[model samples]
Target chain A: MSGIVLPRRQLIARAGGLVAAAGALPLLSGCDAINEAPAVRKILSMGEEMHRASQRALTDRDALAREFTRADLSPVFRPNGTRLPEGEAYAAHAARGFADWRVAVTGLVARPLSLSMADIRAMPQRSQITRHDCVEGWSAIGEWTGVQLSRVLAAAGLKDSARYIVFRCADRIGDADYYESCDLVDALHPQTILAWALNRQLLPIANGAPLRLRIERQLGYKHAKYLSAIEAVASLDGIGAGKGGYWEDRVDYEWYAGI
Target chain B: MTDLPPAMPPVRVYRHRLPTRLWHWLNALTLLVLLMSGLMIFNAHPRLYWGQYGANHDRAWLEIGSTRDAGYLRVGSWKVDTTGVLGRWTDGEGATQRWAFPSWATIPTRYSLADGRRWHLSFAWLLAIALTLYMLWTAFGGHLAKDLHVRRGEWAPRHIWRDIKDHARLRFPAGEAAARYNILQKLSYIGVIFVVLPLMIFTGLAMSPGFNATAPWLIDLFGGRQSARSIHFIAAWALVAFFLVHIAMVLLAGPVNEVRSMITGWFRLPPAKGERA
Candidate 1:
């Protein structure tokens, strides 16, 4: 009698385990289903907007990211995403120390200027030792030297209609050139610079040599490297996939990558 | 045969409050999503370090990576092969995948940092807001003072030791005594609610570059951004440990009664040992 009862109980327990496993399969798939739902995605995206809004409301417009001393700088600031641009144009520019490369300032600007590397160097320069926080959760501190993007915009005389500043980079990943955008507030911030030097030396080729955007408050992806052009626009509606940045367009990365 | 004596009816009591029950379930869902998605995020960079800066060249205190044929986890000088479970694993599609965490353990059940962030940040708001409201309720709504407060005598070494010994022996409080939290339960609950949860929230905020600008002191308080990140990872595991023990305790104490109390706020008390009902 005892043996018969024990076997039946064991069978019941095994059946229960099977039922649990079956239930778990649906639950996992349900998570995927909920993730794919468009309405749910929209709600999730609101968190990004809320984060941006709350951060803006809490901090001063000109609030600075923490700057580290030289001693705190990483021995090697790891170069990420498009270390080197392809094709003869970038190669030729690199061969010549980028002396001939020009960063065109166009779109909604009173002065549509084509500034050479020399022209950027002649402008007022600011050097800052700051931490570069990557979206992938690594950080590196480096000293960057460049002309403030605000100073460049001032030189170009931004039109009243201009609400956004778009950065065009020489590096192309997949079909289109790497690009990024920012609102006028970030564009005009004192720490927003077009850095041409790193670690008090000419920026390495792998590290977006010649020129790169240093939007200090944002993540690494927002700092467009190997800059080719800067455009002032009223809206990001006509930009690449209308998301204001390449990764933002392709991978659903938040445009305001402050976090 | 003589007729069996009538058995005693179990005593039922309203144990968990509405706020506690609601927050407990909400937190369960929120924390699960947060942990899973957080693992996916960690897959992007499966290394951790200390101080202000840490990158590929800098020495990582912890790393999970693959080399040719083997997947390994390294913590300081110690290393272990974690091939099938972590660093490398086979996905649902029967393809070998190398990532810090397995696909089943991540949300969307695949690798997508963007989607992971979406789920994490969305639930984070729910967690933060719910935690704030729950903490306020616990503080001013009399939940803390009445239900969780330890009497002066409960703090005595003898009393605390007795409770610990009882737990070790699996000798749970019975009858009316089971309704109130013991000193250990009260202390652990207080530690989790007031200390660990808040630490998780703050450390998470500290990792954000944007928030760092607004509250640089947070980084300073945690030693550095990377240090804050390490602490965040450690605290996440601490929570996982807490959850495992919590589930085990529920199962041991009587899962049906414990779960029903959480869900419906009514618990049936177990009768005292050697007592004739």
Candidate 2:
């Protein structure tokens, strides 16, 4: 096996040829081709997959994101992505202090739920001060208190077919409704929360008030804010543009934004 | 004129080896991608902060921001409006766009943080592997001792001062001495290889949340991700300065000779004056 390894130059040449071939295959795939050269597509997918696999393999699956001291918290945690979700429906919910708000949990679960804000707050609470690293090159620390998503899934009793957890948000950017998803691993992680409080107070509207998904290990975008519903599915094929998230659909943001 | 002897033949000596040449070209490409993509990434949050956390509402040590009609550059309390150049600018077709660095400086030549990251991260992997191998080869092959390492004698004030003075006068050693690196070259190379590159790689890893979980100590060593980011940006600029100075020296010494030596490994050393072949 060692003797069969080609020299670096030969390996590069062979890879380049394969990349060119991959680039040419876009014609057959049409719009599903990710709007990039197949070569780039290959590299991006391979890189993301390798990153995900390596993280899973090399690190403890339950290893938590670094927690910070209260001193480390930003004076005011910045609101990222869509601040206040538009439309009268969300405004009406906000007006009544989310008295009528209900998170409809459906699909591939034995007990589908329509849990309210009061119900979520009533569940076991976990609060931790953690850093939020934005993909856009800034980081801020904030204290978040909410229910663990794993407990919610367990309450609903996940069916064997449920492989992914998708969050549908009320915020709309550019023309589409915002959405994001995660695999079972992150969805069931101990730190993953349905956070409704920040800095010892109710979550401000700008910071995904009422509720937001806090998948601590992922980038800020994956923490989908203004969350309205949770859906369990076996495959992401039918999700928005078949890529999982709003940003992932619109742009080529990786579905598995683990970092 | 008739009494003057024939000019001495310039001796050809091996300067950059194959590994060095390979590393040079690869680094050139990778660093270019890293810098351009890095600039694009920076444009997303054109602000810098100290300590562990910073956001829009928090105090930023530095920022390049734009209003609806104008651009401003801020450092702590100081603010400078730099319209049509930074914060806001016109592209090639005269369309206005907001950017800290111009579009020409970024990858894709347009605004796309996602694409910038793809280019940056992909090349990052390539650079890490290449640099690790190059460092190993340099250390094991005696290249570090033979050419890169500054000798104890060379560190003497007089010797260092002479080298600096010679450099200021655009004077390089000739003949046998020219074949080996000067003290300045040795020190700068050492700084870049040992200090800058490693810092870049470490700070980069510190930014990755995956690495943070696997090696949380790295983030702590750098005083959190935001500090690591600040250091990374500062180091990148330092590297840019090093690159500019390196190119300037190459141009001063003789671009053709210096560039050819890096490419082909056979450097033609200038003959000593008043010496016959």
Candidate 3:
């Protein structure tokens, strides 16, 4: 009952510490409006604990959210983000049918690769009828076929030092560029893919065309569109804003935006 | 005046009731939990963009990224590492493992997505019920509208301005309930109780699969499912920020007297002379 410690502070020599005594009395009243109610705080803490527990419980990349059937596709699969890249570089790539397009896989790797659109298409592929969960609150189910990200990682070879995978993009939001990332587990996930086509067609400009990541297990933002390059890194510290992604850097988006 | 017969006080003018006390304090506590847990959840997948409330190429309602689900998939043994650590459950004697992500900032997940779904949904129910009951009782019993309703006096521009000034000073003025609550308190309480919480609850339901069909109006209200998700997260952050600041204020304003009134439903007073209420 007696175990209590309160840090004491001086009101200071700056100005009048005036009426410090009156303030002291309310300090004695527990559950004063100034203080958080214990139960609510407990719930808040509990919520945090639950989240921590969830993190501790789930981590294997192999276990995937069940893939749905083709009938599950939304009547209207609204596209999110830039429908089409605006800049000359993107326009040039778009014009060429992205045939000459190349995706560079560098940064902390054994042997970095610069793969062409054809090269990516040639890799053994898998398709899943899954939902595209956009941050904006709509979901569209589409059958996406592409090379398993794990296979590409195996070929490009990630170094031990690499802890994060960054996707450099060709799209820009406002002034900053579009980039996103994931950790090794997510990076190595079997369902994680870089799809060049959506619903049996080369993805249109509205839906991350030519090449866009369909990180099936995650929300859409992690699926960096307008694919330009990918980098693997040890820590997110040195990257843009040291947080890992483009939106994360400019806006306040969290680094590990796992769904 | 007491010498005559010390007449029994003419029916107690005001007495603190335990139920009211419990409701108030519980409300306070639950809000705190909701905010923190909400923040931890947001931190796990921090990304927001502005646009129309739809499933269009522009705006989004929610963003259920890999982190939200994958972050919670840790199984059996979970560990935290320097870079960051998360989990996964191995089934069939490690022959197979499902669910995995790497992160520390995320609110801790308890199990696979299914488990998370159960826990989160259940807790959401708990909050929904508690708030609902509290609101109903307060409304029917005339407790909330009577005690907390912003009056003409409170709404008066001068008083409101004064409260704003006092708040800017980061100190309540010397008066009844000045230390207790002033105009600003009403604003926040009203914001949360009347506005934010409902938005939170409704948006949550809007994103939920069970409610999508039953409540089509909700879906139309926020544009789409993803938009609801975004609103949910952003609004969550706002509440979390409110809570952190609120807790810091409690520590600053003196937690004892504050806690006591909510706990005991009584305040050893300075009377209206000094008390701001």
Output the number of the DockQ-best candidate: 1
lDDT of 1 by residue, A72-174 (tens): 8899988988888999999999999898999999999999999999999999999999999898889999999999999999989999999999999999876
Best by lDDT: 1
**Tens digits of per-residue lDDT for model 2 on B115-139?**
6777777788778899999899989
Off-target runs (Cα >4 Å) in candidate 1 are A1-27, B1-6, B274-276
- Candidate 1 global CA lDDT score: 0.87
Worst 10 residues of 2 chain B by lDDT: B107-116
Tens-digit lDDT track for model 3 on B1-277? 5445443322212334566677666766655445534544443333343322233343322332333224232112432321112333322223222223221122222111211222344356566777787677767777566666777888899999887787677764433464344677768867876678788888876754323423456756987555676777767777777777777766666576556656776544333432222
How well does chain B match by TM-score in each candidate?
Answer: 0.96, 0.95, 0.66
Off by over 4 Å in 3: A1-53, A56-61, B1-6, B9-23, B29-263, B266-277
Tell me each candidate's i-RMS in Å. Answer: 8.3, 9.0, 14.7
User: In candidate 3, how many Å is residue A126 off?
Assistant: 1.4
Estimate, for each residue in A1-259, the C-alpha lDDT of model 3 and write its tens digit. 0000111111121111232233333332222221123454344334434433444354443556446677655555667667877888878888889878889999998989999988998899888876565543345667888988778878988888888888888877666677888877677877789888888888888887888887755556678888888898888887777766765554333343333
TM-score of 3: 0.50
Q: Would you list the C-alpha lDDT of every candidate in the order shown?
A: 0.87, 0.82, 0.58
Q: Is candidate 1 or candidate 2 better by DockQ?
A: 1
DockQ, Cα level, model 1: 0.35
lDDT of 1 by residue, B1-277 (tens): 2565578788899999999999999999999999999998888889999998898899999999998777899999999999888898876546788888987898856577777888988888999999999999999999999988889999999999999999889999998899899898999899889999899999999999888887899999999989999999999999999999889889999999999999999999988775554
